[model samples]
Target: MLSACFNIISVCLSLPSLSHLLCLSFSLFLAPSLSEGVSQMFGLVVSPLFPQGYPNNVLETWDIAVPPGYAIQLHLTHLDIENSENCEYDFLKVSVDGVVLSTLCGEKSFSELRSTVNPALYSTLGSMRLTFQSDFSNTERHTGFSAHYSAVDINECDDPYTGCSHDCSNYIGGFYCSCQPGYLLQEDNTTCAVNCSGEVFSSLLGSLSSPSYPGLYPENSACSYSLQVEEGFQLVLAFEGVFDIESGERGACVDSLRIRAGGREWGPYCGNVAPKDPVVTNSNHAEVLFNTDGYGANKGWKIKYTTKAKTCPDFVTVNSVLEPKRPVHQFKDQVRVTCNKGHEIVIGAKAKHHFDSWCQKNGVWSDIEICEPVDCGPPKEIDNAELKFINESSPTTYQSQIYYECEAPYYQINTDGKAQFTCEADGMWRSSDGKLDIPHCIPVCGRPSNPLESIQRIFGGKPAQLGNVPWQVFFQSPRGGGALISDRWVLTVAHMAQVDQPYIYMGFLDARNLGQGVKLEVEKMIIHPKYKRHLGDSSQYNYDNDIALVKLKGKVKMGPNVTPICLPQSEEEGQPELGKIGFISGWGRVKPRQTGKIPVSPVLLYAKIPVAKTQSCTDVKPTGPEIQKEKFVITDNMFCAGMPGVDSCQGDSGGGYAFQGEDSVFQLKGLVSWGIECGSYGFYTKVVNYLDWIRDTMAANED
Candidate 1:
């Protein structure tokens, strides 16, 4: 037994040497060129444009073995690629024994490909096999590759297609077999067969073989199949339409479709059937469909679309037939609860317009919504200048107020005839007589338009009186002013001329011949009672009483040549808003829109800026919390107007806001107050709101 064991050990010790001798002898004939220093060639066996790996191309496999503690070095070539057109290539791969090592993209110098190998790695590898596989497919020209070996042992497996589910048979240098389950091996096992279920399937997979797809469908190419399943199985299918070369329409007007399953058959449905709006799209491709219960018990059934009897095209294609499904309604029958009898429920709360939800007891309606009764403030008695409150019960909400005042000679008023009262709980206030009085009205100078016939000839024939017509005059200030009540009192915004320097030329028609015309220095210039020269908070759209009356030094002349325009009845009240047209004239700058250089025009030019709706002014402003809190308050007393692209400029301030009124008349509506930016929508004060106050002030001054 000992002797036999020794013999076996001796044979085992020599086995490795014997194997190396055999490998060397075999390589002698096959790799003679490599032994003579000819380098090996490595690269993509075929181009990568093919959708699948190379067609009808076989992989070349070579075996190699490196005993532990030893590494093999080999030179490789042909990896260098010059500028070649259509140069899309698969990766070049290297392997050790039967295991893959690495894959690289594009081409590299022969030195680089050879240097990619690590001596320590190759030394540890026991066996390897190099395969030149066509990783891409094409019907174009073929490219073959070869390898050179100086000294190496080839390690090939018994069954190259090992682990394959189907029959794996070993051949000379490689193995072959078909894939198992859900697939059938093609003539070349490299390609696998696909399995389709649930509906009629074709061998070509994605592509269909129906005839005349879009315009017409041939009966012979039409197909139908069935499936068997449990009581409630889902039926899913997807298809796409094919179009004709000429017409863009779909196959033979699909008049109707029907599906038969379980024991009953669904009716022949119209081609217009669709889950979401049945109209088809351009690409006409369908992806997935999953539906259950709608088709009853899942079983062998036919789904098809048919045309009207005796149509040009006979049968409809499967592409026209879509999978039908039932829709779900999330809300069934929901109810909402209302508040107690004394309280009312807002429309959005009790009867919601969207998302349909009901109200419960603890659910508060304040946040959601709540309806309230309409309440108008109590009536006030306008006695002279005092406003007396009769009823006071309702509460005030927004910027609600009952303005108060008294008529002429009453510097202060007594509310309720006893004391000047304040706003009451019911939103009412008691005033002296609801009006203020003026001291003495100063006469405003009118331009000489018609002058006397002899005076007109000397002043170049021009009309003097033309219903508050603006006249050319010389004033120290850049801006101009207007007449408020009569030819004596002139209404000019306070900012135009400073308090220290004030002068007026009463009869100056044109600035060119200024010294030749009648001139007068301002004697007593009375600014508006509440006129703050600075823009002030009024720039915030709040003009807290901006009316002034100027008293001239003396009343020089009067007639058709010079007469003050009559003031409208209610000077401070808002007028009935009927589309009003008026003109604005000024001497600040003829073309203020032009650059720094201004036109030296003493003559006022005017443009008709139509009054715009208040809503339009608010729409153009920027929206945000800052703008809202800073300047976006729309008060009841304020009136806004302007055309979007056009507006008054610097020279137009303190000018008249004229509009046609009752009895075929042109009257001054309001006065220009203050504006931030020039040539932007301008806002004006409503003259009608303060008519009583204006008349009272004028009368008080006159006294």
Candidate 2:
């Protein structure tokens, strides 16, 4: 009710002063008798698409009351299908005052009798009672219907003269005709005139029909026609479904149809039909007119035969001719080789001849090349010496640092240490026997046990002749000979007073001259819980039993070259005929120095080396009988020696291996812990393997 009369005229305009006289007396009295009774019942409307059938399910709503000037018209009829059926048409909705309205579905069948008839609205959309909908839910038959009208106007010329050939123009209800300019509009709309009249009557209508109507507008007919040919005409176009006359922009131009109709392939339509005008000077036949307003607004059905390309002519093929073939190219090569004393190159040093060649593809070789073999290590002859190899010329890149210089009269003393070589990508060179620098002091007096001479005496000092004793003075004390086992105790090597800060470097022998010694603070250092150090191999005598006893914090002043060696009570009272040559002095190292650099010496230089048998030292280089059938067991109070070209390298850590007992004096027998490379072979520990726990840990450290 117009929203309850605009809410009672907005509560009578909130009654301040009768709100503009109640909206001007409610629009001069209830809006023109309620919009003139919904514009005369929405103009006695009829088919608002109700339960129709041709395809079934329909819906159409209603609601109008619009007034001022009006304009609706929706007249949609329905037959919605039949091109032999299956042209489905279900929901086709249309609206008006509620906007929406632009519909067309499954035509055919009077093309769903379409007509908005003037549905465009903006203002005069007053008496809006428009509503049309159709949703033929899976219809077996649902027809259509929509009938509306406000400012009505239909008169579709009621088939005027069926198709006037001249002046007709009358719309708002269709009708247009202005032919007589060469005549056209003729699809049974009462004909216009000449479509093609001449050349023996277009060759007697292309020899009696079968040319399927006259081009364009004649296909599925609707209206909008056009035709004119002042110059003879014979327009014939059959092209039905997939018509692709040699498709070159979908061919079919016939500006002058003098084509004698001689092509037929009917399936996809190309059934040619040209050949009209026989002479008016060959009439040059010309009549190409088509404009069914884009073929009645196209939706399939195109037979445009416009004619023009030189009076239509197309069809060509014609093959035959030959000669040509030639192509081939391939290659390989890229070399490299390397060696030293163990010599190399017994193969094309990484050769790759001509275009990187390696041949045999599918079997593997199209490219990847490699050739490695170079780490020539131990072969530089030394026993009775006679090695001379010199093939230098490497500034780096498979480098070669040869500098042994000892051939004039033999002075080469490199005990072998640091040097390098590396050149591989297969030219092989990373290592082929050319690396020797050896330093940490290698002298091996008379050549025997030189352990980078105790890291070149501590760091680097003692050389002038072993007696020039300044290999920095020395200080390695925390145990070992706990300086005169009594006299305030000192019988060392208990894993060196098991440190965690138990410092006791007493009376300096140069730890780079520890400010001249006397820094002892150990009141303990007791070893011989049956000592252990010898980790396997040396007949496995239960490890080094190195021994230890310390106690210090006082008692000093003793000389005879810092005196302290003398503990041999048994084994037949330290025999050499019984004790005397023991001077096994330390501050370690007789040869091991890779540049781990630490050693300066402080003094204390003594030597003795001689601890034989143990199978004559595993029979000089023996660890093989296939390594004791792969597990050789040689344990039993371990004891081995070194002499096959003598060795002991690296600052022979843990010092002493002295002998001579049998009374000729000299005692302590064995301590230097490791040696395989630096000395090639040197391991020791036995002072008679912990002589009864070093005499009961020196009698319980002198009580």
Candidate 3:
């Protein structure tokens, strides 16, 4: 209602207190142009009759609001009014959310006051109000004040006291708080908390207590705990803690506990003499409950429970469709489950849908069999090989036949039999004859183009024909030779490649011209680390771990005269080959050259020798410049291969000793490392021991 002096206004704001409700009537007055927001951006504000004589006894107010995320910024540019004691005669005031900013009277410019808290006032909650009053008697004419208000962005997110416990979002003049997906925002709209009614238990043995164990339980709470076990077991509850639940007169339960299970309900047991005996849940499932009144301070119940085998829940699978179903199967019954037609039972790696499953003495079925759709998926990918489907399949389910073939001229399936596999019902690829290894693509290697015919025919030592030993590396003179194990790698002894850049010659075999052969420049030389460490501070070097790989700067062109040798495929392949005859070829000096020219082998000479007896090899007194005075350690990593008339002599160091296996392919057995003399059963570093090292080094350094 409008009044002569003021408008009776009633405005209420919720203040944070015990009651949390507050209402205060503020005298509100809007003169012409005062109530206008001016715009959302600004609001024009001034006292009554600004810049002219003003009347008295006037108490008025103007309330301003801005958009969320922004606060109302009030700027007073001018101030001129009648002055009186304590500004009681006439005054203008600014406030926000019930907090007063300042009161002004008399004549004072916006800058006439201190820089702080005078010319401008801002609201924290995006709302601001002002009050103006005039005394009934004015001494003279005065222009009260001229001010403007606008929305200023309030960064609520930057304020730690904004009440957001998690994520906070701010917009033009306001802000809000939010929580993660699984959490619920509490009543305050700022806290994220998980709301759960009770707890769940799955263990075989445990105890449940109401809220706190020893202390008094919480007030005004209704909680439930759920327990579930395997279908055949019955849950048993035994109450054992202090029975102190609140109760009314005549021992009625004011606070109580209840149990519900298998269509049976237990008591609202209270006044707790503590249910002295145990309560049996005749079935497999159960739920325990504990409720309380608003007023209660008592230690609640504690239940120690155990499960016993009893009547079990019915069993049947939707997909498998086990037959002879029952609504309630007893633990004592020995009934068996059977699958319907078109489905066969599988037990591990076998097919026996029926008898594979059995009822155990513990009342639970062991190895419960199930029927499934026969599917083997796509056959596993075979390295270096592709497959051809032949059976009725796209081809990988039941009865799918697949044939594997190696990737062409460089590789072949290492089997005389058909390289085939079939997907059986057991979900595995099996051969027709439950034998033979899976199809693997092995390199077509170790085979020589120009054969040596027989090692015996060579007798003691002779020059190899151009392609007789295709895998031999022709390192001129006594520098050190190697075996071409791959297109770009050569295997040799570590001691021979002590120099950083060792050169390799392939294709042509000419010791006379030396550098005339095709020289393969070495890019990297990896010596056995153990062999390198054997070069410690000692008078003598043990050539025990003498093995190294040389990587050629470029791949060697394969032809009739240049090819790779095969490595030992299996772990024990070279072990049983103790007494086998092998060949070692090198361009070494049979005799020293005169006048600064060390004589290389006139041709690539190879020695036909048998692997000597270990006793005879280790029996001899060791000699040689490399062996020095140290005892020759004939470790298992070295083999003795040579007789009196046939041996890898001094200049044969680092040469590969190749053996023609039963497959008619040459596998490098060893490398000529050290010997007592030019003969004395030549000691070669066994190639088998370092097979993994060779393969790993080559694979890691591949281009």
Candidate 4:
């Protein structure tokens, strides 16, 4: 109805030439009833009905009222009155429920004006009043403003902007506040506050108690408390008094006290009996929540919280030398230590004593420590003789060396007058005799009263006893033999040295049981620079520089069965006089068949062969034409060692031809190089010719 009235009024005002009587008739029909005072459940308001211009000094008012639980919205559609910046002369003012909403004037128009009340005055009175006034003047006039007002249901819950603590409910022209079970709505009806006093606390030590503790707590009350401490300290919470809360099935608790710390949630404790022990946290922070239902509540809990410093057990000292040292103050720190040579940690003792040690949280090392050196007792004493210290420092540690001299009244030195012994890494003494027993200091060389065992003319040689020739070593894979000259070097012929997997066996004499000997792997091989093989032509092959040195992967521990032979001091020391008998030993065939093929020997055999002059070597019958041409070219680097029926055979190419020097110490004089059939003249590599080169090569490769 109000919209229809505004439409008629607009048409009437637009037609100013209309008769005054017609205008009057339309105004009487369209105007609101005077008895109702221009106020309705929903209505529209406009300026006074005048054709020319509104009468000067006029005042008009309209009141709009909507049902309860609704609000009025006014929208000004057309506005044209006077033109004044402040609307001082002719203006319209609007108020909702006696509270001024807006005042408009001049020729201005408005989109919408709502009935909003100050939050402090939260009332829902559903009425609004509009007043239009004009000063006494008849100059200019136009169609005044028209606005539509309607009562809309006030949906307080629909507008999220409405500030309500927990919940908002719309009522008749009003809204109210509501909260969850455990919270209370504040006086402002917007925010909520817990019923308890304290909410959060932070300190090293403190006490947390429910509201009105010692007495039963009020129903529908909840309290949350948070406690924090230093980063390294953990919070410990313990109940100090009787505790009780509502209990439910399956260990659930109503009106319970729950503690949360270290990312873990503890029990919702709610019984009369207190927990047996305090609850500790893995971190520095802890949060506790105390909730109560509307029913039974006991004298709530009083929990005492304190902080403890995180620490570990005391560190233990070790016996071995530590790299960074122990007693690490911080967690995750590491320490490393190593045992000295000849000293080692026992098996399974402290991670073998050479492992990385880490400091654990318990203030203890992750590894153990146990290091001990191999001990060889004091040097053995010789009877009827006094020992004179040559090294001046009596040494007994593993692999330590000691030199001594013996007084020669009744006892005589075995080799040179000066004797020495070594403490082996395996806790044994190696005497100068290359045996475990102490040197007897008996007659030099212990010359037999009668020559019982002759070195010459033995068709089949016997197996040498252990330690008889400690330097002799057998080569596997390409069966051959060599001599251990140093801990890391083996002297062999170039032919025997070229092996894919060169392995050396020492210590034991019986070649049948080579596995019982000390086995060593070869790391490097240095063959003579000029050594070469002439394919199938053995005579054309250069045997002059057949010597080669093999370096072992690791030093071989000197022992009774594994020892180094003395190297010649000079070329003269290594040169044997012509016709002087020398011993040659190997694990080769005792005798070769007439077919010239030799079988493998199981026992190490030795025989004495006279050294022959180069001219004599040429006189022997040559096996091939290549030998006849090479025999005359035999230089000083080559020598002959055998005659018919007595010789070193196949597999003895690298065996040692050693002779006891004037000093009574055996020296390597030759290396078996080649032979023209077994038991015939055999050529040997004169070791004296290449002694300098051998020494230089060893010194360069030493590690």
Q: What is the C-alpha RMSD of each candidate to the true structure, in Å?
A: 33.9, 30.2, 29.1, 21.7
What tens-digit string does per-residue lDDT give for candidate 1 at 487-556? 4455655555445555544333455565644454444555556544555453344444555556666543
Better of 1 and 2 by lDDT: 1
Query: What TM-score fits each model?
Result: 0.30, 0.20, 0.37, 0.36
- The local distance difference test score of each candidate is 0.39, 0.37, 0.72, 0.69
Off by over 4 Å in 4: 1-460, 533-540, 593-597, 622-633
Candidate number with the higher lDDT (1 or 4): 4
The digit string of per-residue lDDT tens for model 2 on 1-703 reads: 0111122333334566554544334332222222223434233333323335433444444555433333445444443422223223343444555665544445433343542323342224444443334443543443444334445433434545344545566565245555555455666664454453332332322222212333332221222222222232333443334321211135543111223222221122221332232212112232322222111212222333432111211101011111111121111111222223332333444432122322121112243323223333332433222333343443222233332333222122444533233443333333345323222221211111122233211322133232222111222443222334333555555455566455545434544655565555557666666555444344322334555665666643332222334455666553232212222445555444445664533445554344555554444443323223213334433345455444443343444544543333335555554333333345555556456776666566554
Better model by TM-score: candidate 1 vs candidate 3: 3
Cα lDDT tens digits for candidate 4, 119-177: 22122456677788888884765767666666666877887878775778888567887
Overall local distance difference test of candidate 4: 0.69
**What is the clash count for each candidate, in the order shown?**
61, 110, 13, 3
Error of 4 at 276 (Å): 84
Which of the two candidates, 1 or 3, achieves a greater lDDT against the reference? 3
